[model samples]
Target chain A: GAGVSQTPSNKVTEKGKYVELRCDPISGHTALYWYRQSLGQGPEFLIYFQGTGAADDSGLPNDRFFAVRPEGSVSTLKIQRTERGDSAVYLCASSLMPNSPLHFGNGTRLTVT
Target chain B: GESVGLHLPTLSVQEGDNSIINCAYSNSASDYFIWYKQESGKGPQFIIDIRSNMDKRQGQRVTVLLNKTVKHLSLQIAATQPGDSAVYFCAEKGLDGATNKLIFGTGTLLAVQP
Candidate 1:
């Protein structure tokens, strides 16, 4: 794709339900990242993937949050037992390298009721 | 516990005037800085970037100045336009034990007046 793409622009899930957000990165890019932006706040890093392997998951708030990049191009973020606090905009970005400029997707706005 | 912060939460500028947005980072290990512009309900777009090795970088009408001595970063937009009105965010990348991580600061809302 020309830019990073995220699916399901908006999602409203019930509390304690599972939700999954998807991200399709630019072609030929090897680095992908997930960040969450809360109201009135900057984006917070969640996880970063280098190819198919997760290089860093330390930023994940808890064990309930998980992400995967099966073939190193498309990634999915899964949240189990979602809470109301999970409501936020989840942004996906991809870069040619670790230090390269990041291209971001419009993001998936998740509103957990 | 990286605290990247903006000096001002909002900036209003006249169209065709030069606008400056300031940011500060507490982590001295940060070696890279980037400026991003985000419109309402949209993703952040890359504006410009500067490496710590250099003090200044310019791209089109955008200029980024980095002051390692004071750990400050500034973005100057020349001939600001109405389309330039957006939320500006500054991000820092550190090279200590933390790598491949960019910490973003609270953005500044830039409003351009005619």
Candidate 2:
């Protein structure tokens, strides 16, 4: 079975630009999560969706970070006016249900110059 | 503020030696915990998990011990191999309804010398 899939394995952009990262969760997974990880650090929570709606968005750093999961499957994490501080690996994970062990994708490395 | 932290930043051991990684969490409401392993260019991979009700759980070549009294968790790997070299993280999730997002601690890098 295919694991969680993330697009644009690497993305390099200038500061103040807009970028979108996509995630495809495992089949039948109802819970999807996004996290950001810096060098030599653990992943930090971002947002999660239980189905089509976000169950929690509190982990989002600011208003510039937004995510959406339409039709209960594919999800896109959008960032507005990217900054150098946002340069990190963006990870996506999914589970069979809430509280279940998460299966993670390789992640998209976003580099804002 | 609630947080999860590790006691060690790195551990270097010879292959065939056992390895232990420790974590401390501040949120007493947290009922579930997990250990994840990550390599250089990949995301975390689930290693093992334990619930608050249980004190210990064992998986292949690994064991997770939980001590709610001290708010501590530890992951032990038996006869560690070269392939076990990676960064290990401990994640905690509180019992807050359907929102199961995890709070992760700073990782510990395990370097195995074969």
Question: How well does chain B match by TM-score in each candidate?
Answer: 0.89, 0.90
Worst 10 residues of 2 chain A by lDDT: A36-45
Superposed model 1: Cα runs more than 4 Å off? B1-8, B95-98
- Once model 2 is optimally superposed onto the true structure by TM-score, how far is the C-alpha of residue A38 displaced, in angstroms? 0.7
> Best-fitting candidate, measured by TM-score?
2
- Model 2 bad stretches (over 4 Å): B1-8
- Candidate 2, residue A34: the lDDT equals 99
Write model 2 residue lDDT over A46-84, tens digit each, in one string: 999999999899999999999999899999999999999
TM-score for candidate 2, please give it: 0.95
Q: Model 1 Cα displacement at A91 (Å)? A: 0.2
DockQ of model 2, rounded to 2 decimals = 0.58
TM-score of each: 0.95, 0.95
Clashing pairs in 1: none
